[model samples]
Target: MPVILPTSIINILSNLFCILINISLFYLYTFKIFYSFQENEISISLQIIGIIVNFQEILLRFFVGYYDKGEIIQDKQLILLNTLNFNFFYDLFYLATLILSQIIMYNQKNSSNLVVYFLNLIYFLKAISVNKILNKVDQLLYITAKADYIYQLLKLIFKLIIICHIVAVAWHLLAQIETNYFEKNNTWLHDLNLVDSQWYSRYIESFYWSTTTIIILAGPKGSNNIEIIFQSVIMFATMGTFAYTMNCIGVILDEQNRKQKEYKRDLEIINIYMRKNNLKKSLQQKVSNFLEYLYQEKGDIQVNKNSIEVLNKLPQNLKDDINVEINSKIIQKFKLISTNFSQKIIQEVIPFIQEECFLPNEIIYKHYQYDNLAIYWISKGKVQIEHQQENAKIVLVKVLEKGDCFSEYQFFTGKQHEYQTRSADFTTIYKIQRDKFIQTIQKYADDYEYFNMIKDQLIFRNGSIYTNIQCLICKSRYHRENECEQIHINKNKQLTILKHLRNQIQISRKPFFRKCFYFIKTIQLIKSCELCVNQIKNNQELFNLIKYIDINNNSMDLDQSLSDNYIQDKVIKNRDNSNSSLSSTSIENNVNDICKQTLKNFKNSIIINSEQINSNDNFKHSQGNKNQLEIKKELQNINLLTCIIFINIQIKRQTDQQLKKQAQIQIRIQKKQIFKNQSIQKKKKKFLQKKNLKQENPQKKYNYLFKIKQTKKNTQVIITQQKKKLVI
Candidate 1:
């Protein structure tokens, strides 16, 4: 047969074993130090080891919540009821109890056995009482750990308490050593009456003395001036430590009291608000019940509606700083907000969020009854997102705990609400309205198109089907209902890129021409897509091309007949100058071939531009005119400013090029006329010289001077004729 012990006995034995193990390990560790080193080395080494272990244990508890990392195991349902300092307190208490019990049992010769038994019983009871207090402290630590700063403060307090206890124990040890040193020599300074015979009794007596000195109470009398001086210094330190500890405790208590008062004041204000508004009985009751639930869950109510309103009225930067300091972590933990946006955006958004509270089982919104409006971030308690069926039955879709968000999909998508949300308990949330959200995002978003892309992605993710909706102008989505001004803006950008592409093709070197052409073709291809197509159709500026342009899949035909006629007339003029034998039929055919090739070269561009203008009609739908007009006006102002700057630069460049070309052409013409005049003069002079040479040889030789004069006269006459012709 197996023997079994009761659970209570087993637990007590287990605790005793743990205490024994700690003491044995500490003894062995101290013994190792004493054995391996000299006396002075041992003292310093032990001090170093104690300090290291104390801080190391504290840091481990602070960071990992345990002294030993390997002992930690994650369990969802497990609740830790022990604190970091509990182990230190428990060990010290157990050691003191054991020593006291041993002393009481052995010192019975001086007292009755019954009195010793009663003292032991009292000692055990006191141990139990201290254990109960430690257990309560452990429970309190569990709650404080939920708050980061509070948890750290609590840990710091525990560390201080342990440090003080260690100091007290060290003081007791020092006092025992001092007493032993004086008593063994039979010195007059040693008071045998104050010192106990047993080492344990002496240590206990020293501990009581040390406690009195540490608390700034009456302490042991000193024997000499030197002792008195040392006691005075120790007394001063004790007073400072006591004061510091008291200040810390007072500060913590004051903070707790302040928070409690604030909570109570908020509840009163909420009651007043409800009365002023003359809210319905059901609504008032809901608020009342929520206040009660809050107290139960959090042990305090925090109704800050007035505070939120005050914060909202402050400067935006100040408001943002305050909200971020308080609620940044609460907002960042939500999946939608964290994954979709950056920290800066989150910071900007923090100011717009409103703190809201909901009662248990309170309906936030019903499915199909409200549009996708606001997003709710749970800061405390829980909420249930329920999907209501067509038959009016509700199914719980998800239970969102603290740090989760509700209606987030709606905020991103602009879709109608798909589900209803209800508070599962007393809940607090940070609410961000859709319009405010959009306004905030527009500040950081690059442009309306980028913003629209985010919107589309959100809508698609939420399972909204967008196919089969025809936008006649842009030939994309159903623009009449959607009414996106961004479509117009994007169309303007595509046109700007097309114009830039043309400029690059004209100015770029031959080696880059092919690349430029390919790039233009790519832009044109992109422009033919749904977004750009809608942009071109809806925009007032780009809508004019539809009246006289035709775009086919393979061939671009934009005002083809007019272009053919222009090409033929140009060819005819060229023929007249260089080919007089060119027939009308040959000229027309040549012009047609040239036109065909030019069209082929620019076929991609024409098709893309014409595709933008395929639809002749305009959209009549308009919504949010003030907002759209304001944005449009702002864009127009920006574009006009940029265009003015760029156009002036371009005009200046073109004027310089034209002046340079004209100057070069004039210089070349003057050079040609000069050469022609010089040749004519030389010819005339040569002819006159030949005639003079013939006359001079045999009476037929003419006077060279007369010949020269005649030639000059001839040259002068020619020059005069040219001058008259030029003047005419």
Candidate 2:
């Protein structure tokens, strides 16, 4: 028969087992799981707290171990002393025992009625809280760090606990079954008499015993060697489980710590950058708040922590896959993209689509600003579009929610925004920058249609209604309803005016042309007339001689008839050759009169020539007398030159004597000046040497040299001045 343990003993051992289990898993729950989630200074404090918490459990376990011993440890003082050595609140008890007990109870290590239950409840609460914290940490780590080891370990731990419970239940049920079978066969195994009414009682008893045996190191007072071996095996298995869990927790902690540190470092770098840039307090606060919001939203999600950096670092294929997956929803939600694009085009644009986050009331873009280079599609939260007036008043035009987009219309059209868009709350959006959009679209042939559709849609929406109905030409609205006032001339009127102007110009030009033509003709006529007159004048002598002969012989009519006949022939020929307005008869008449005049003039000139010739002879005789007088004057000038030459020779003798004496005096003065300059230079050199011997003062030496140079310069100037005076 198996020996059965006392109920009191079993209860104490069960509690002891629970405490051991809690102690073994304390680090795994608190430090490895919970504290590891934080990548900040707070995490360090948490880790310290975890260490303290785990130590508390261990201390309780120590107390239980010592308490499990027999009455030999009955001395309360000894028990207290031993506990105090390992306790965190050992110093608190020195002042008062009352305070000490209260502290011990508060610390969950009091020895009093229901103390064990209280400790049990405390351990259970700790375990539950730790577990919850661990779950949260695991979720964070899974998202941001994308760790698999911790997840696998967590699953394994849960499975192991279930298996442990199952194994314990099965073992206890087997023992109970064996006992029942023996008793039913009326055999003496342990006189186990089981009835239908006691089934619940029996089940509870088995479960309790199994739990105690599997968990507690101390075996139940029992029993066959087989039962002892079973308990011992479970004990050994639990220790192995503890060891495995510890090792797994160590690895998880290390990985978590590494990621936490990196996150912390990045945040610290951002803060440092803000401080270094002398950012405004308000701006700094905004940045800090935004970062905190991001942390809260993503909470260590893989797409939050270094995800962008990772994507940048990834191979092309993997990068595209990730980007497409992340941004596919964002693209699909956009009305323009979904309606006009193909799957292929969407995939092509995925690379250009970047996720952006903004805080509440954050300005995404300003009204009527052309500087924005990207289109924003809201994936979460609402955006407010405000129209800003010229007077700086803001009017809320529209409120856009999920699946709605902003900036795309103006962004694509390359026009200024009609309204400003701001985040109504913490917002997540997908944006495609201008350069990236163009680059991506260009790579895919199908994307052109999609891009065109977007452009067309934007154009339609933006131009759907004319905000201001002012005329484009005159900028007037009320005077002309939806139309511009026409101030420009019609085409027909313009052509008529131009033609009229041309006609007027032609009419005005007629007089000028006529005048020019008449003047040219008049010049030609005058030239021809002059030529004819010249020809007539050249034959004047012959004509005049004929006239004179006729007059003297009393046959003037005969001579006139001959002269007129000759003049008529010459004038007729001149008139025939020239295109001037002259008649042959007129020319003949004028020539006849001119011939009579020339005959009279010739008679008078002949008489005048004879008188002038006599006067010229008398003038020549006077000029001959004047030539004789000029010869006599040249003879006097020759005599004066000889006397002047004698005086010049006497003056040259006196100047030559004076020049010789001056040259001798200048030579002597030059020699003396040279000797004096040489002596001065020697004195200067001696002075420099003496100054050098006295002390090596560069300043003094420079001053001395400067004084000497000045003196020499002055002396040279004086000498030159004196020499110049003498020369003069």
Candidate 3:
């Protein structure tokens, strides 16, 4: 009969078995208690944390791995650490799997990964926060792509099956413990009375009492005791079942996936053909599609992915894509995508081309003009291109300083056209004729290497970048597609500026050469100023502004608005704010006495509006001349109003001296007409201001206009006056 072991003896044996198993797994730890063990090693720290996290990751991935993503090929090196210092296959598999499991659960590391690895592996002397760790954790999310699911699932199942089987074996191993290795003992082998007389004493293996019947399965088949025979059959069947299951699983995982592999091979073949054929669209689309497929298939729990992790670090391709689109549009607009040409160079370049002489207000080009070249480089100065609108003038573009080019396309394409061109300031341009440009490009492609890049970037080669800036300010980006400014610069404007400088030269009584030089410099400066550029939207207004400059006067310190193109003049105290003053005392009395003597020699400047302003409602709004003298009126009447109103507005608007001069011209014409009247001639001609003119009393020391007389012409007037009152 079989003997049953005591409960006390069974527990003592089980406890001893548990200790032996623990000692085998963590033998080094037996040297010290868990608390006393050194926790300094980074790898060890990571391993300990990994022990807990590995199981968690396996569970998390199991639910989603198979159908969620595709297979990923990874480097085997990162997993090599688990294969270290191991003999048994099961132990090596378990350790390797623990590391693999964690890596698969997490996403691939990034630049932040170095921080995470160090933190996880080593306990830092300094403190760190959980949030810091969480941040590192977040970076891993990107690498856990959908494609790595197959590997993740297979890996999880393999680990789980092996671990469960090991546990069962461990329990079974514990159940058959015997105190003595050499002496005879009744082990679990006799529980069902299957052990023969020599079963325990014989040198046999397989974790059961060795018997010839058990090893050969011949004597063991005797069924005299049916219960013992049944027990033997059951144990044998159980052992065979577990072994077969493990083998089957290992084989299934090792099999090749022919379908996925075939698809990849076919895709590569198509991509290679597209590249060889130079099919741009097809090639680009294929590349993009292939990239999408790779990411979709290869990145689940996909932690610490080798090469794939670096892909996210690549420079973004979106901007390059946008540039491609822009370049495409630019190319589409061209009449010829690629052309070869030749040119004959001429030695005698136009003086205007060499000297590049331009005043600030000089018109550089006109609209509807054609040239064949596509490149224009700015050599010096600034330029503005403007457009005409229904209600007002709009700035189309602006270019400043050197190296700006405009309208090189006209010379190259063999198109004859007319367009208005203006200089934002006196500017120099290196003009290249299209024929010459084509010949040069054909001869020296290296110098114009940027041509292709520009084409690729889609920047237009024709328009000046400065003109574009002005246009941007005046109109929204949408309005650029409409008609650009190409109106003719009126001759009247050139003459107006010329006359002002001519008058100044006359007043100085300087030599012809000196006067001409002075005029050029003054005109150039004013032309470059913001006050002129911003207000000179159209040709007519520029003409009037030129007319308004007082040639006889010398004060020309530019206000900021004029220099900077600002609309508002913050300097120059407004009359509204200038009213406050101090009570006059002895010093003021002395000043008044001096002023009384010279006051008689002064004459007020008659300011005028620009002719363009007079024609437009915007100018009317500006003038506060609400009562429309809008119709052509006596220049004298308008002159007085413009002068007074000019003082109240921004200094950059310019004094309307020119428009007031126009009014004076009309007044003189009227006077001439009156003189021509048959009976009116008989009477002494009467001046309009004669009645209001202050009489020079013999006792009065002061003569405000001692020698000044207002001489009238056709709506124009001139007063001989001292320079002091007119200037400051």
Candidate 4:
């Protein structure tokens, strides 16, 4: 098991032993006259005590657990190693030397005093280490106490005493050492006529000299060079010690007067502000009186505000408990809350119960004020409610003291205040807004219903029935402004109003610029639409088909309608001339085929134009250059002819698909027959041209034509021979 010693007791005992050791060492060794073996009973007694204390400490090093980096080490091996590493060997050496010196003094009466001096020196060194340990213990005690000033003063006094004792012993030692160089009578001790004085008297004189020199720099002058040098060194060391002592005292006094200093600073700032604003003396006095009262009542304004912020950072449950502790009495005073609400509901409302302070006669709320729609509970001081009679006389209604509530009926009724409320004195009140209270209770269904019922009862008792609340914006009784139907309508109306304003501004501008801009935009749109239409019209075959469809179907009028009609008339006349060759069904089939092809081409053109317009819109949107409104206006200005064509295409798209398929098949067959007929007609034309050339130049032209025919026949015969060889 580890041995545990009370550190406080150990520290006290150690300090006592250290003082005894220092006194014995200084007197017995430094004076030398008191070093007689027979007369050193006091010194020997101290040495015996020192031996016991040192032995106890050595045992403690091994048995008692010591702090290693804040944790206590109790393992025997580790504790033994730790003890051996620090001061254990040195302590053992000192103990051995002390024991040897004691043994020598007892057995050998004529032994040298050098051994006693060495033993005293070792004991003094051990005492110095004990002083350091005591200092650490003092610091620990000081940290655990509240009286910092007292602890510091005590510590300073103790250090001064120790320094004086050490210096006194050294000063006498220096004087004794100087006797080696010169006669003993020539030293400072002899100059003071005290060389043969008793050891106690000599020690007292040395201590008095050290104290005076160190504290006040007032002491006898040195008689020799050694004495002068020692005195000068002591003076320098004391200068710094004195400065540090004064500094510590100053810090203590400053801490004690910190509050007063802050108060003065605040007052100075207020005075400067008043002077800069040039306030009247009477008003300034009133302000000063208020400030005095504020400071007396509240020690520091910033401290209170900082405390509130600190409280807000606490956990919610902890804050709730604190709030309950602060306002439980005030909450119990409210009959409506205490009787009707559950504990949980009361806790929920506590967070929103804000505390407000008011000065004497400060108007908290005026009569019929819409903003004062919250319940007030007086937590401190008094409140006075004043009502104005119909005869224009102000009457004091009642004086409300602590725990009294006002405006409870108004809070539930959602009505304006009927009386003015003012603070009767320096008052503190807790306010709970009606909306926050309702919102908190809403989480509990039963509590919310009960609250509403109480609110209705309160309103009825005041001779006013609860009615539906109308929307503030639209005056609709069914819903609030946020839920009103007119909100979207109002938004659209705002847009229209902005548009009208813009149009009015444009009308006020120069018409020439506006007209030019509109004309340019229209021209650009027309050009784009015409470009798309012209691409379809540039196809000669599709254009011809369009003309035929326009002539036969007469579905809609077009730019080429007159020409188409004229061409149709000529074709009809030719058909009339060859009425026997062509039947009516063939004419109708041809017309139908032409119409189908035209409609297909029109649909494809419309699709391409639509795709291009959509792509342009996407590009403009990506570039963010043109807004949606501008794009819409440009689309609206498209050519009217394209609109009509699109309408006609849609109507034709609804036609029977079987007729279109049949027409397509007939058209393909007729195209092949026409191609064959054209080829045969070209051959006949070539033969006719050859006959004409032969008639014009009989010999040479006819031989040229015959040679061309012969070359064609030879090429055909060579192609047949190559085919026959491949077959073989």
All models: lDDT?
Answer: 0.53, 0.55, 0.39, 0.68
- Please write out the lDDT profile of model 4 over residues 1-728, one tens digit for every residue: 54553344654466456555645554454444332233466767866776776677677666656666535566788777877864678768878877777787788764466766577566556655535655655654654445456777776777777788778887887887777565555777887787777777778888999988988887877888778889999999887987787788788879868866777788889989999999999988888787777666554435557878988888776677778877776677666676778999887777777888787888999989987488888878899988787898887866888987777767777878778899987787888888888888899999888778866765554222333333444655444333456644445577787888784434465556334443448888678667646754765764565565466345323323443343344344655324422433454566556555655665576567557757775565544434444444333433343354445555544432333354456557767999999999999999998878867868878688789999999999999999999999
**Best candidate according to TM-score:** 4
Worst 10 residues of 4 by lDDT: 461-470
Query: Which ten contiguous residues of candidate 2 have the minimum total lDDT?
Result: 30-39
Query: 429-523, model 1: which lDDT tens digit per residue?
Result: 88878887688777776543454665685455422232222332343443421334543443567778888778544575565433444343777
Q: For each candidate, C-alpha RMSD in Å?
A: 35.0, 32.5, 37.7, 35.4
The best candidate in terms of lDDT: 4
Query: Can you write out model 2's per-residue Cα lDDT over 1-728, one digit (the tens) per residue?
Result: 12212223532444344444444544332222212222245533543444444444434433332334322343445555655663335322211232332345447643343643343334323554334444534544554556676576776576455445445444544455555664333211242443332434444454465456545645454456555566676677776765676677787778767755756776788889989999898998787767766655554445554767866776776677677777777777665556655676677777677777777789988766776477777878889977677899997756788876656545566767666788997777888777666776677776676566556654554331212223334545332211233744444677788877784434454444334443448887577556544543665554454454334334323433454343444333654323222332343345446544654554465456546656666667666567545434433332333344335435534543554465456557767999999999999999879768469777877887789899999999999999999999
Candidate 3: where are CA atoms >4 Å away? 1-147, 154-478, 482-728
How accurate locally is residue 232 in candidate 1, as Cα lDDT from 0 to 100? 74
Q: Model 3, 1-728: lDDT tens per residue?
A: 12212123432343334333322323222111111223345534545554554344323222221211222212233223322333234333454543553464355533134543343223211111223323322333323334343544454454434333333233223323331343334434454443443322211222232223223333333223443444466457445544555565655555434445555676778778887888898666867576555443433213324433554555456434433444443332222222221111121111112223455567766556554333345655677756555575655544455654455334433444333457765455544355544454555465345344433332344333222312233443222233334433344677788878774434566566534443448765555454434533543533443343432122223322133231122123333212211211332343334333322221111123344455676554646453334323323323433453344333423433433354456557767787689556454434433433445454332342443422234224333343445876
